[model samples]
Target: MGVLSFLRATYDLDTLDTRFTNTSSTPYKTVIEARGDAAASKERAAKWKSQGQPSRWNTPEFYLYYFVLLLVIPYMFWVAYDASRPTDPKYKLYERLLRPGWIPGRKIDASDSQYNTFRSNIPYMAALLVLHPLLRRLYNAVVYPVKATGQGSRPTPEEADQRLNQRATFDFGFALVYLVALHGISAFKILLILYTNYQVATALPRKYVPAASWVFNIGILFANELCRGYKFGEMAALIAGPTVQNSVLDSGSTLVSWGRWLDSYGGLMGRWEILFNITVLRLMSFNLDYYWSLDRRSYSPVEKQIDPAALSERDRVSIPAQAKDFSFRNYVAYAIYAPLYLTGPVITFNDFISQQRYKAASIEPARTLRYAARFALCLLAMEIILHYDYVQAISKARPEWGRYTAAQLSVLSFFNLHLIWLKLLLPWRLFRLWALADGVDPPENMVRCVSDNWSTLAFWRSWHRSFYRWSLRYIYVPLGGSSFRTPRDAARSILTYVLVFTFVALWHDIQLRLLVWGWLVVFFMLPEMAAGFLFPKAKWEGRPTAYRMLCCLGAVVNIFMMMVANLVGFAVGVDGLENIIAGIFRDFSGFCFIISASMALFVGVQVMFEIRESEARRGINLKC
Candidate 1:
């Protein structure tokens, strides 16, 4: 009775009981706080004849969830920490902390070289962020006053066009200078690539632009990697024979000197290839956006009278009313917009152009500052994790995993995924925060915590959300992704995922393992999609507890599958993942551990469900 009383006091179970017991045909309407719309979601629910909103704090299962979490979380961490500790006396902890001359930072440094590089470049990114606002202020002071005089309170359409054109020209010049300073002579190579893509859009017939642009841009990207950025004029040799290559190769020493000289400006000089993937995405954005605009088949219309601030997400990425905004000047500026150039929470060409003309309505100084604080906290958390946890180092070392228990190996893989999550989240947030402060709002790449997700479909939706959105608009939708009008064809949807992931895998790296990982992800989603169809909410609404229990069971399986896919793709290679799986199933004890772990995970999923319900009550349905 006491325990039941505590549970009753903690959760609004009465609301949930009423919701479950009632068989009302009419859907309940609640305020949609996320969109500030109360009736919209309610009407949509009614149209679909779907169940009403979930009750807030309605979960009665949370006590068990908390109890399981308390035990599992600490045990996992304890095992991971114990297992990862260096056996070598030479690599002393005191030395790692103090950094004496004898002790190097091999252990202290992140095992993942990419993250190490990012960590080292934090200062440079910060410096760029600082310098950008000053430049923006200077431009505004010079330009805004002149435009404000003729146009009364709000600028007229013609004046807005003139202002945007001038800004684009200035941005183009500045971007060129910035790229040259950052990448030295190699900046010309990037510009040439962009120029070629632009020509494909402008010179080709509208019918041919889509195929031509994709083929050329994707072709160039693969070629760039295959030729290793065409170092030592090898591309020239391959294309134009030994004579032209010899001419270019003869000046290698001079090129080296040039690179060294340019490196004085910043350490990242002549490393344009490192950031070329992001550039390629921007290239495609310009090409496709231009192609779409030429047909006047507006994905979202941008009429002269439409307030840019009031436009929805789709509208912001639509082509502007004036065709001149699609000029080479604007294209260059949008592609290499310094804030988003290094690593993007990608903004489409139209969105970038629109935001430049009128600052995003989302840009609030207080909100931006709060976001900065969040970034700082995340960075600090990552630092603390790195300082204490050496799971990444252990994974890199590739010691005898057989020696460690299944739980330890599981925890090791688990923490490594978390590290991957944080490392990515930090840089994306930093760059995005910079963009937000500069009055441009790119998509937030990481929304949900890595551990918070349960559904595979929802996981993809939230993780690297900008990239997901980009792929959806440019690739998925065009490839016949089922929206409201079209009925969902499972086969077509599966094929679409295959193609999308194929592009995604290759785009990340031209590696076989990533491709395999993508296939694994597709395979895992089959069961999830099937389950969603087989055991939909409408069918199980009467048996709420049973339905919740069933979902929790499914979520446990999903969590393991997700971990396996990610582990194979990012943290550990095929063999390492093989070891983890083999170790887990090698004995009866291992089997028992799996049973216990699954139960714990089931509880965790119950908690996850409630969390989403809580968010729904607040009118923030992430749909993930």
Candidate 2:
């Protein structure tokens, strides 16, 4: 009996939590609403969350999936990696295709130009993380002690304000020092930009604040990009007057060398303007959040709880506290919080300032340690892939299309997209982990594996989830996005999506390709939206077989469109995608290949559906 009990306990035949209670206050409602879509509220998340999840191990389809993956994935990987080999028959034909500006004789890591900026600073980031706890303890000791007024008592309002002021001062001081070190003298220029924006936020009429903030920040962003962050050489030349400037500030002059050395010493981010896009978002978050917080009726000016840790993530993010917390000191500290300054799992002004007052539930130590481990593992995985697969190199080199089959180009484009995802994912995770260690719980950026996606809408939601949420709250909602509103208006939503993605494209970079990419994303989303509208599960659930079949087919189409859009946008660009498309239609063989691939995608979509069902059964509905 004892042995049987031990075996049963260890094995746990019931792998999933089948019991799903649907009470009003159950966490699932919050989860659904937090997704910020009215569609989710219409029993999508709720109904799914209540379903009993069966183990995939019990299903024959699972074995089929395993077999297919075993057969296909390895072949895909081999084809992708094998083509880059020097011994491959076509390698020499494309050897000269390597793009310029990279090392002439060496294989290029296209992502290295971007990723090395983060990788090279690993030492600095590591040292800062190590010293962070000690530094925090020091700050706590001097500014706001752990026991401010002895064990059980809290400090008086005056004392609390003074302590907080000291802490903010300390935060701003550290942020200033770090920024100056990172951007050299250009840090002042950054501060000035923020300061001027700050005045606009505070001084403008309530109605005008939003418009002014948007215009000023975006205008400055374009100006900065155009001027290349006010190059030190240009600045010196301008200061010197045209007559003497040409001779005095030649490329080889002492001043030129000095500027170059300073930039090198400061690391690659010395210009500060390069990272201004991210800073611009934070600036908007601050200014916009503050502008909204001004209306006393809508946003209660009361200090309900001096500590906002008790508030939910939703409330903490969307709601602002008393006006006092939105001071310039707090604003600057939040703007340049070193870990998130470069790339953000962007936290809003309210959330950032509030989290500083008290630790939130999200900052679990064991969880953070696990997260850190995951980040390290991801970094290792990226390194291994970079070492083995030169797909990025090959793609950037623009190898001869005539030398490769349609399948080869597809695999190259596919893996290149995966590499792009990993490249962004690894850095975002690293910075997020760093912020976690510092006890600031910014949102996770990449929520799903790039390949795990089957829906175009869901892909964007999972990719850069923080930014999505930021855009949803700040941009989409303001532009009258009907995701959360009642009586769903498709026209309004579509228009909002167009406007949002348009801004998104420009915000990413002042590039024409990105603008096209944004439009393509919106265009692709139309079919998915239309299908969801036509097949309201409530009306079609009686015919589960037909509904499931329809969904599976839709998923396949969604996946295809998603791939094309992403390939055109991020992986291959218009020219490369055009080449791939042309290759596919070049012969009868390519048509047969597409048919087989579509069948494979159908099977994969079924597995993806089951995976989501299994997650829902276990009360782990992500909706995305």
Candidate 3:
């Protein structure tokens, strides 16, 4: 049976007890009853007598894993070098030293650029990989011995998991690696620019010579800002939100829409995105920090017991112990991937670990081939849209389109939006399949498709699902789940939308001012939220036609509001209520009729294509 099947059998409360009872009536029943008790003295004695001690992997084994990972870095570098042939004159010497020094000269092409970049950073990566395990082992070795004597040091599984997850041993190493690599790269680029500028300065007449100091200062500032912003944004996003919550500084506008917009458009120097990123990063980092702190607590064995009631039913039902265990591995794997680290899929630790474990398992060739093909096709489609600049044009026009243009542009925008969604969704789906095929079981509630291809809202839900999951899990649940009272729920939901949208806006760093765009969007979503509360019992019953119409309408209004907000926000930065209201009134005609018509056509095409695809899959024709 598959992992999912195994988990179902193990956790299925309805059938599990019966199977145990039937297998050995007396002992099994006693064991089951004992397991149910919070503090089963008799059962504990029996378990101790029977099991003696739990087995664990030795320190050497742990070190070996790290060593293997370190070796893999070099191997990857070698593979890249072999795949990318350099045409430069220095290539022959670089190639000759490959077997000994494992270094290669740079190539100007894309492949060469990627390879050289990875190769240059191999030492840092390898150090990070090795240092984590080494420090962990050192901590264990040093700390355990002192506690073994009457001083009372005990190592629990939770503590070990915490240590593993925090990767406390390796964090500094990784930080240093990042710093060195980033600064080194920045310095090189700055120096090159400086040299170019000096050459230009020298070429000019002596009487009209430009000050190289000014050019140098600018280069220095640019490099400093880039590195500082990247690091500061990352650290703040990882660590700041909770810290600032209780501070006096936190009392400022809880709904600073305009401030957020200014932050998005104003560049990194805009305090909004930087501050917001810091807050989010801090929130995420809190989990790891909390888990690590748990290791220091000397609680009774009973405290170690998993409490399903403590967690929400949804989370409890979705995650199995095996999945949780797998997440530790996933955290390490995903953390190192720079792209995801900066802008996440916001995956749970459990999901990540499961993905890694599954990737390590066996896979079918045919299934792998199919996954590759799907990913390639999705990527190709995205490239085509990007190359044509269709999405960019629509996005640019969105804020200023008159009524007709607004309608027309919304339609065109839908296709581009669909392509973007497809790029994220297709690869994710393939990854999901790859995990399942390799024996990793996904959560039962994972969304499979845009709501029957009928609702734009559904499409939004299906696209970048990790964001939805994060919003629901972190924001919605904490405020109180859907059982919230009508007025309170509506208010909380709106606030949640504001927070989520603001976070997303800051995440993109489009401009410091664009944070207002997020706020405006949240304000618009308020109507939808109110509608949701008013029709609490309205079920989305997969009625494609009805949902599709609703979705198109929602999309049009959303895109229209977004465009106007963005334009005004960017132009004036975040302003007071009076200014914002005035700006909206002033730009009321920004929604052009042509744009509206274009948006209509775009939606029509998408709807038609969706219907055709559905029919093809089901082998049934549907008349338009």
Q: Which prediction has the highest TM-score against the true structure? A: 2
Against the true structure, candidate 1 reaches a TM-score of 0.84
After superposition of all CA atoms, the RMSD between model 2 and the true structure is 6.7
lDDT of each: 0.72, 0.74, 0.39
TM-score, cand. 2: 0.85
Model 1 clash number: 0
Per-residue accuracy of model 2 over 1-624 as CA lDDT, tens digit each: 476664443232111110112221232224434557776566665676568444565677668877887787888888877887778876665556433323344453434467656666778878887786568668878766643553433344445465556556777888888887778778878899989999999988788999999899889979998988776767666666788877877645677556555445444466678787888999999998888887753454235542333456666676675688888999998898877988887889988876676555556565566566566767777766665567777766666675677677777777878888988998788788778787777877876678788998889988988899899889988887666233467677878899999988888888888888999999999999878877888987588768878899999989889888888777778998887788776888888878877877888887788777766664565567
TM-score of each: 0.84, 0.85, 0.41
Error of 1 at 475 (Å): 1.0
Per-residue CA lDDT of model 1 for 337-413, tens digit only, reads 88888889888888888777765555656556556766777788877667656777777766667766878777778
Instruction: Please give the range of 10 consecutive residues that has the lowest summed lDDT in model 2.
Output: 13-22
Which digits, one per residue and each the tens of the lDDT, describe model 3 over residues 1-624? 676764444443212112111221122224434666766756545554443222212445335544654654354334333322444232343343232221233322211222333335445644543454455456557743222222323334444344444442243344334423444333233234334443433344533332333344334444444655333223343343655634423444333433333334432123222223322332343243224324444532235553322222233223433324423223333333222333343545433432332221123344344444444555455444333323323233223322222223333333433443444454344444433343332322223322133322343354455566555654456556543366776576667666666656645454556577677766765555555555443465556446545555655555445444544443334542234334334444434544534354345434444544433333222221
Clashes found in each candidate (C-alpha, N, C closer than 3 A): 0, 1, 68
**Residue 503, model 2: Cα distance from true site in angstroms:** 0.8
Instruction: Compare the candidates by lDDT and give the number of the best one.
Output: 2
Between prediction 1 and prediction 3, which has the larger lDDT? Answer: 1
